[model samples]
Target: MNTINTHFRLSYQIQDEAFKLSQAGNCNLYVAISSRAMRLAVADVERNKFVALEDYELITVFTPLQIAEQLRLIADQSPILQEQRWLDVRISVSNQFFTLVPETLFDPTHQEDYLRLHSNLDPQQHVILYNRTFGLDAVNIFAIDGVIYRMAQSVFPERTVQFTHQTSSLIKSVLHQTDRNAGRVMHLFVERNYVTVLVVDENGLQFCNVFHYLSPEDFIYFVIFVMQEQKMNPEQETITAWGDITPDSSLFNMLKKYIRQVKFGKRPADVGYSYKFDDLFDHRYFELFSLHFCE
Candidate 1:
């Protein structure tokens, strides 16, 4: 523990009855990978209910391989890691290289071309993925380190196939919960060092991107910039938010100062939660909880 940066021990054992049900191989493992935090959760695949969850804050950043080794260690230590269920990996890396390409023209084999849209595509260090998260007739091409992907697979094996962008699933979660039958809306997911902004209407996803920030000033700047880029008026558009957000936080206070319609989002209505989870913040952990809606 001395060499590690910030290791917050995560422990949540389900009740005897819940443990028996989970042992039936009915739960799926959801892991959120990021430089800021690594969170794990178990959900009933059949009923889409949240069973238990835990997280770690990685204050001391390490090489991607080092982080992978840490994750393998975590998987090895968890009692439920051996369960025969799927492992869903959500990418929340700080640097995002993404582009929207038409589905008809998007070739999975040509994923690197789209990754090149943002920067010089790095094949050796980065692995690329072309995904159709939004229902639009287009696919998003993005990349993370190859080491991270392989490390996750090595831990979970054949059960780990679903890979997706953080913004994609969070956008879907927001849309699924919002009454989008009316008008265009915006949403934000704020973490300690990063902020993700998304705008959508009845049509589909309008804009999605992640920005890195060190101070509260930098945080609100990016949020407002996204709104302006999307031509969304803060007064008219509702901006629902979650993940490391609070009404009293400097970030939220700045958001409310400018955006009249700003408010905290809710958990997905379809999922059930254990009483143990009641102690966690409702405004946070939406990314971990929203993994249920990823599929």
Candidate 2:
């Protein structure tokens, strides 16, 4: 049997952070910095091992500056490495402050590239939209394909079909019956103050807007408005909340209270996907642990 070899290299300064590298192939190299001292040490290493001795076949230096001059020198001497895309140029900044920078500053084309990269990386990507307010808690919407599925407001390990299916049908009915073309709605995510809805079919994800509302009524109104703008009907749609609601002060009950409060009128229908929050991840653990010392 013949083995295939692959390598990936990444470099970052103390201020910079890399979320995750693409694992498209077998080889990966990641270099991150924590302090000014580390950055200086990296610079020294680049000068000696990278520049003077030329010890490695692939070398990428992550620095604050683009260093066009240094890149030119490296490209001239290290033709093979440059041809292999071994060099990555990046800026160094504090991790705390970097997130504060608007996406436009890093790259004007960040959104396009971000979506493309994510789509390529995870073809079966499931989107979850969550929002939390004082009286109105979190509403999570998971989008798979063009269909939006709702997750329970609270996170649970075990899958519950009642909330998931109900939420899916509600959104499906709303979108299908309404004038809004599902194809136009591109991406959706939850942000701090509001739910950021992106619609990018032919027009691209640029036309989408953030809907800001303090209450669930207002939030629903905003959804209606978007639907109406695209010509969706108000009467034809129903919004139902899903998740487990317990009989006692249990996982099921808590989720039930939340769903009833937001969805209105409808009672939670049991779909046989219920489980204790503690026993959600591994039910066998709960069972085994319970029987460990019992007679």
- Candidate 1 lDDT score relative to the true structure: 0.71
- Tens digits of per-residue lDDT, candidate 1, 1-295, equal 5353434345334432364434436667777877667776777666667776767666456578767766666666665555555445444443466777778888887788667867676678888876786556777677777888887777666564577777666766877776657677887888888888878788777787888889988888898888888888878877888888777888888888888888788776788887777776677788877777766
lDDT of 2 by residue, 1-295 (tens): 5242212122221211221122112211111111111111011112111111111112333332222223233334432223322222111111111111122243433433433432332334343221111111212222222111221111112222122211222232223222344344422222212433333333223233445555545545555566567543334433322211123423324323333322322211221111221232221111111111111
- C-alpha lDDT values of all predictions: 0.71, 0.25
Q: For model 2, give the 10-residue run with minimal summed lDDT.
A: 91-100
Any idea what lDDT model 2 has?
Answer: 0.25
Q: Could you tell me the lDDT of residue 98 within candidate 2? A: 10
| Candidate 1 minimal-lDDT segment of 10 residues | 8-17
TM-score of each candidate?
0.87, 0.22
Which candidate leads the pack in lDDT?
1
lDDT of 2 at 10: 24
